[model samples]
Target: MKYMSICIISFFNLIFFSISLFIMSLYFIMNEYVIFLEWEVVSLNSLSIVMTFLFDWMSLMFMSFVLLISSLVIYYSKEYMSGDLNINRFIMLVLMFVLSMMLLIISPNLISILLGWDGLGLISYCLVIYFNNVKSYNAGMLTALMNRIGDVALLLAIAWMLNYGSWNYYYYLDYMKNDNNMMLIGGLVMLAAMTKSAQIPFSSWLPAAMAAPTPVSALVHSSTLVTAGIYLLIRFNLLLVNTWMSQLLLLISGLTMFMSGLGANFEFDLKKIIALSTLSQLGLMMMILSMGYYKLAFFHLLTHALFKALLFMCAGMIIHNMNNFQDLRLMGGLSIYMPLTSSCFNIANLALCGMPFLAGFYSKDLILEIASLSVLNMFIYYLFYFSTGLTVCYSFRLVYYSMTGELNCSSLNVLNNEGWIMLKGMLGLMFMSIIGGSMLSWLIFLTPPMICLPSLMKFMTLLVCVIGGLIGYFISKISLFFINKSLNNYMTSLFVGSMWFMPYISTYGLINYSLKIGMNTFKNFDQGWIEFIGSQNLYNKLVNFSKFNNVVMNNNLKIYLLIFILWIMILMMFLMFL
Candidate 1:
């Protein structure tokens, strides 16, 4: 039975792999379809396939990473979700998520793109809430609601473009001839991207989304969903290249980076901390995108997927080892019991912390170099640098608190490294974490700049990692401070202050106040005019008046009375005129 189940799962994976390869090849073959259509050498209407080849090196690299991560998620799920009653349902959802994400990556038109965009969001919500518990339901609901805001913006932008007779991405490219319209579209696109990416106010849903299983969190949160925003911006790079919208992107991205980094510092739940770190890393990618460093942003995205997925999976192993205990406080001295798990966890953490010779080091350093260039504002560069330091602090804290501290509780039955299936997945991802940068360098146009201090900068980054880890270790070891004090304070301030203040800042405040006043005026009317009418027994009086009129209208009496009333009215009007 187990062997049969494995074969069925393998069959599904084979189908997915085949589809991915076919789409990738088709995208490459149709690379010049856009150019040919644009130059009018080929009639657009005559073309059977509406081919907009998103086959640039950066996009191809990202797509490859997406496919690789998604395949691992499926493989991991085969074992992870082995005996659940709804295992078939889970596999179906996983397949759908992969399909939607692929559609999103290759979509050439804004309208078609939204099909995949909304589809992925829906699938993710389903995946997150797959356990169907109350907490998971709440998390799914929050994700659905928050992403709706982004979807609305995206829909509006698409509507606005379509209303102006632009139905496709190519039309928008041509429409950019008008600088004003270009700026408007750019602003709307950035708004959509910001919300989808969970920048600032939109970021709340992401951490809440951690109620999902570790694999779901690993794939959706770390590898795919959040990266969608960065992908959109990069996909439409020409629109953002020289516009005020680019500045807005930089500002929002910078704030998200700093704030999420700080948030990561305070989170106690292992998954929640990783979620925040994902947010911060996404912010850095956005910041890099805004700087027009597509290659660097793509590189970072690749490296991030590798290490973040590994981290979450390692966290999963830890949780599983401890019999589903997610709190790091209760998880101490796990290294001795689960050496293989701890080793993989440490390697992933080191990569995440941007240790030298790791994937993160090269990609992050490239972003920092671009940020430091004189073209960007000084404040922006410093903000990026500060966020980088914070990244180190949180990444290592996750490592120290969970793995290396003194043994506090008796060890539970630790599962054997769960054989080759799970570990193979982790090891495959770990290999990418180590060599992703070198692979990316060959895939993309990025060449290491011939700067004298490249080595020095690498050393400094490592030093920061070491120092940051030490600080986190000491704080965790000696301080009487509560573990999640910083996070609690931050969330409290956000909910109590900012969320409350939103009503006052928006036009809704005036509208709500006006509604209250209007209701009071209606109340006054009811007390005065309506009360007078009620005192007269208006409905009853009307019935009585009709009864009296009916009696008077009886037979000849009705005719006499009508004549008399008409004469009296005529006499009065005549007298007034005279």
Candidate 2:
């Protein structure tokens, strides 16, 4: 009860602060006022250690949404972890997680960014393992290891930036583009962001991290952990314009978007499906970001946070009532029983599908429209639209299985939307999911994004979305005959559905070869010839020589004395001759 009250009180405080920050951000955005404050922590020779805080409209705005979602996640967790003994610990970890994100957002210094960056990774690992089970442990390990790749990349970027004398990459980002030696920093930064965002081979950890408690999922997936990378990219997006690597980033982000969308369609687990959608949205942000539309990406990022948080909260409510069962195959007709949850879930889901007048439409539609207007190849253009379609496909698939389908539950199970606290949490995001898009759209863009495109190209997004929805609905109702027929292409579905074996590639695919080589190294070197020739062989020879000397000295003292006398005589004779 004490812990519960703490979270409840904290939630109210955070929400108040979040609202204040949002208002401040609007003022900052309108006036174009950037408040940069720096404190000199220390100075060594010419190098001054300064901690910098950047309160621009972008950072302020992004941090506002982050705090808003975090506040609700805290409020939601009160009931989510109500029965747990360590709700206090969970609250601490969640707050720590939010603080780390705040640090990352406000700092322009690479060193400070990394401090916050590493804090995020560390706190996330703690949260992932909060359930303290083998699944959580494994998931946490994967999450930590995967994020460590980004941490190392960011560390390397910091080291490379040392040549520039200060770790403030923001100050030097423009200068970095011209110097070949310095341009490497952009690639390093890009690599770091990609790893953090869980692109391609790094993608497996995002889904597996669903082993975390649902409230953690709501926070991590929506606004904090995954978005951290996208936010960083938004900060450095200008580098993508002049660098040759931007094309590669575009391709990678597109593939990540498409891959995650496909994976979500095939996923059965409720949380994992939402997790995949988060990944898909991340990829979308990165895609536009690589194209140098940082503001659009940021816009999408903020909007995505609102709806995705609501989506996860709704999914949590469902899972909570379903006795922790997350398989959508077993969840059906949830709308009939839990009307409020179903309504929120469907609205968030539709927003995810980029439905008109919703938060997603304002950003997502603009991104695709702008991308369509760009002078890009047909392949890249198709990648953007096709990935959008897949987003709708998987979203409607979820609706079919969870909302409108037959209720597949065990006897004696009772499902209702009874938790007022959790419901309140979802309601805040639900209202935002409806209006957050236009709200952010108005604030972020002084002028609307204009794209003079053919009508077919303009309407293409809606057309694809509709067709994709129909396909997704029918796909969810797969007939037994089709299931039998798909046995032939089971391998294909397995490949695509399993994120193209990305989970395997990320987990077993990554670990097996490394572990195999390590074992071989141990067998052939550390435990084998090196052990014999290095320490063991040296020890054996030293012991044998010591024993030989001991036998002569102890067993034959006369011989020892005679040798000493002979050595002295020889030394005396040699000295006399000299």
Against the reference, the lDDT scores of all candidates come to 0.72, 0.88
lDDT of 1 by residue, 1-578 (tens): 65337535654564476457546644653462222222223556656434343444344446667777777766776666665767767767766776777777766567667888899889889988988899989778878877888788788778767655644665566546356655566667777777778886677778778888787888886667888888888777777775676787889889888888776666677887888889889999998888777767877887888899988888887776677778777776778767888888888888877787888877887677655543767688768877778787877677777777665545545545654566767777788788976766554542556444566654655565677777766666553275346645666457432333332333245468889888888787766677667864787789899998887767667678889999999999999999
lDDT of 2: 0.88
Q: Which candidate leads the pack in lDDT?
A: 2
Estimate the TM-score of every prediction. 0.78, 0.89
Error of 1 at 48 (Å): 9.5
Deviating ranges (above 4 Å) for candidate 2: 42-48, 479-481, 484-489, 514-578
Question: Residue 431 in model 2: shift from native, Å?
Answer: 0.3
Query: In angstroms, how far off is 145's CA in candidate 1?
Result: 1.4
Predicted candidate 2 versus true structure: per-residue lDDT over 303-324, tens digit per residue? 9999999999999999899988
